[model samples]
Target: MNSHPLFSLVAGLLSTLLMVSCAGSKSYPPLATVPEVNVQRYAGHWYEQFRLPNSFQKDGASAEAQYTLLPDQSLRVVNTETRADGRQKTATGRATAVSGSSNARLRVKFEGLASLAPAAEEGNYWILQLAPDYSAALVGTPDRNYLWLLSRQANLPDSTRQKYADEARRLGFNTTRLLYRPR
Candidate 1:
């Protein structure tokens, strides 16, 4: 079979892309969060600053989340995302602190369609970094597969964004792939 030069070039490019995507950050110890978190202070609306690409939030634009402190000390999470066409999607869930956790780690269960009860699949949401005034935060999962940068304001300064990304990189996360959502 005759192999075309263009075909060979395309194959090489694809292989490189695969390798880059598969190779994550270097080995590191478990991810850690702030020593203490005041859940009440952290409860409020936070705009999506930057995030690692994930299928769950693919094609989402103008994403934001609002947290409310429940009476029972749990949290009510409301996430909203608008599409380019102005269509909006929302997911509401409840978050509870992990036992012995200082309100930094939480388990959230969102309500799925057609289910009166909470979804069985609970995801780990950890607050890796937080501003003293609760103005900004860096949230991620245990394995570092998912990450989100949140801010109280919709428009975050470029310098602050870079600072957060650098912090994520220091925490053993691959921030090169972080995507900024529409304002």
Candidate 2:
């Protein structure tokens, strides 16, 4: 009947609208990293100010990360966090600069797997922003799915924290979801 054709048209239009909305939600391209990173100045302990929710650090509190330069020119990364239950957890990993990335992009691999073979894949760690004094840094993945605001001290000034959050917003992240780490 005529109703059959009308229903088909409506369904087609609805599908097209759904597709367009989905595309709009992913408007931003992968994030960009700073042009260069001075590895020496970047190496040190940084306390987490805030971060996007991640399964690995679910319910983590007082999270912190330490980066040390290794003899091989690689980086040793240590991440420590306290759980809500007052238990401390730590993870150690190795990071190497992505060749030809101006030391701004790094590939990191954490130890531990079902087999002894080395990890075939590495996670992308990009330095998005770094304060001139190297006292504060903003790091995230190219996908913009992960973000962290870190500072040399346990507590960063409120103004500095807001500035970083604004930067993240400009970078297309959902800043409202950023969770603060315990002081």
| Cα lDDT computed for each candidate against the true fold | 0.83, 0.81
Clashes of each: 0, 0
Which candidate ranks first by lDDT, i.e. highest? Answer: 1
RMSD of each: 11.2, 11.0
Give the residue spans of candidate 2 off by over 4 A: 1-24, 114-123
Taking all chains together, the TM-score of candidate 1 against the true structure is 0.80
State residue 134's C-alpha deviation in candidate 2, in Å: 0.7
- Per-residue lDDT tens digits for candidate 2, residues 56-77, read 7865577989999998878898
lDDT comparing candidate 1 with the true structure = 0.83
User: What 10-residue stretch in candidate 2 is worst by lDDT?
Assistant: 114-123
After superposing all C-alphas onto the true structure, candidate 2 shows an RMSD in angstroms of: 11.0
Residue range 1-183, candidate 1, lDDT tens digits:
686888677767865875587567466788888887888998999999999988767545778999999998889999998778888889998888876778888888788852343221223788999999899999998778789999999989999999999999999888989989775
Instruction: Provide TM-scores for the models.
Output: 0.80, 0.80
